[model samples]
Structure formats: C-alpha cells, structure tokens
Target: MSSPGFKADAAAMTRAVQGFEECAANAKKTMSDLENDLVSALSHYQGSQATAFWQLHTQLQDKMRVASSELDTMSNLVNQSFHNYGSGDSTVAQSLTSLSNNVDAGGAVFGRLTGA
Candidate 1:
C-alpha cells in the first residue's frame, strides 16, 4: 500500500493567522480609543446615572477584551498547528525514506546471496 500523505496550503494558513492577529490588535486598539473617548466625554459629568453608565461600559469593555484575547489565542493555535503538521509530515517522510532504503539494501543482499 502507498504511504499516507498530507497536503496543506501553508501560505493560506499563514494569511489566516496573520488576519486573526491583526483583528485582535485592532480590537484592542479600538477598545483603548473608546475608553479614552468615554473618559474624556464623561469627565465633566456626575451623578448615579453616570456611574451606572460607566459600570455598563466597563462590562462591555471586559467582554471585548475577552474576545480580543480569544482571537489572539486562536491565531497562536493555528500557527502552532501549522508548524506541528509540517514537522510531523517531515518526520513521517524521513521515516518512510529510511524504511524504503533499508528494504532496498536487504533485497540487494538477498539477490547477491541467491545469485539473482
């Protein structure tokens, strides 16, 4: 039977990871900018209404941070998977090559002994 094979578009995977990382970075930057703007706009405000608004905003920001973190983690995982697959594929190929070489040498020795 033929050896199993693996094929992947490494360039596409790379681009996907890059895109995820960029999105994460953008999310973080946007959150920071939003926070700055909110603080500036609310600086002159006061009262329980403002406090409630800030609390809600904080919760929203926390969720956004989580999302951004998740994106970054996803990107890292994809990149890691790509590398691992590549390494595993190379190892399998080398093992197959070595096994084939050994079989060839054995066959040659057998032929010599049998005068074939």
Candidate 2:
C-alpha cells in the first residue's frame, strides 16, 4: 500500500530565504552607518583612548562583516534547499504517475517472486 507523499511549503521556504537576505542587508547597513557615525564623532582628539576606540571599531566592523557573510551563506543554502525540494517533489510525482499508468494498463503493482 502507498502512503501519503511528501509535501513541501515553497512559500515558507521562500520567506525564510528572504528573511536571511534581509537580515544580511540590515547587518551591512547598520555596520556602515555605525562606522560613519563613529568616524564623524571621533574626527578630533588625539589620545590613547581614541586609538583604543579605533581599534575596537575595527574589530566590531570585522565581526559585523563576518556576520553578514554568514547570513548570506545561510540564505543561499535555504534557496538551494528550496530548489532541491522542488526537484525531489517533481521526481516523486513523475514516478507515481508512471506507476499509476502502469497499473491502469493492467500491470501488477507488485511483482511476485516466482521462487517463493
């Protein structure tokens, strides 16, 4: 007996991909904006504290870049998954349709073992 087949929610997968992409874009924009604001704010004052602040800013910027890249990777992965799921669903549907056609043509759904 055949059981119910797999059901994929393309809309949900698309939304997830979009969400990741949006998050990456937001991260990039936030980092850029913050960097600009910090640069404007620290335009003057030469001191050890200013040097340390710049170092910290660089580190933060690097971290944010990494985060954005990771988010983009995730989005790509989800998008790939969506395509894979669609392909798999198509394969299964085709196989089932072939099977139904065979059965309709009076072919056995299951082959019996002659030795058994």
| Candidate number with greatest lDDT | 1
Candidate 2 colliding pairs? none
Clash pairs detected, candidate 1: none
| Candidate 2 lDDT tens digits, 95-116 | 9999888866654433432332
Candidate 2 residue 106 C-alpha distance from true site, Å: 10
Question: What TM-score does prediction 1 earn?
Answer: 0.70
Question: Alpha-carbon error at 52 in model 2, in Å?
Answer: 0.9
The parts of candidate 2 lying over 4 Å away from their true place are 1-8, 98-116
- Compared with the true structure, all predictions reach lDDT values of 0.76, 0.74
My TM-score estimates for the predictions, one after another, are 0.70, 0.70
Off by over 4 Å in 1: 1-8, 105-116
How many pairs of residues collide in each model? 0, 0
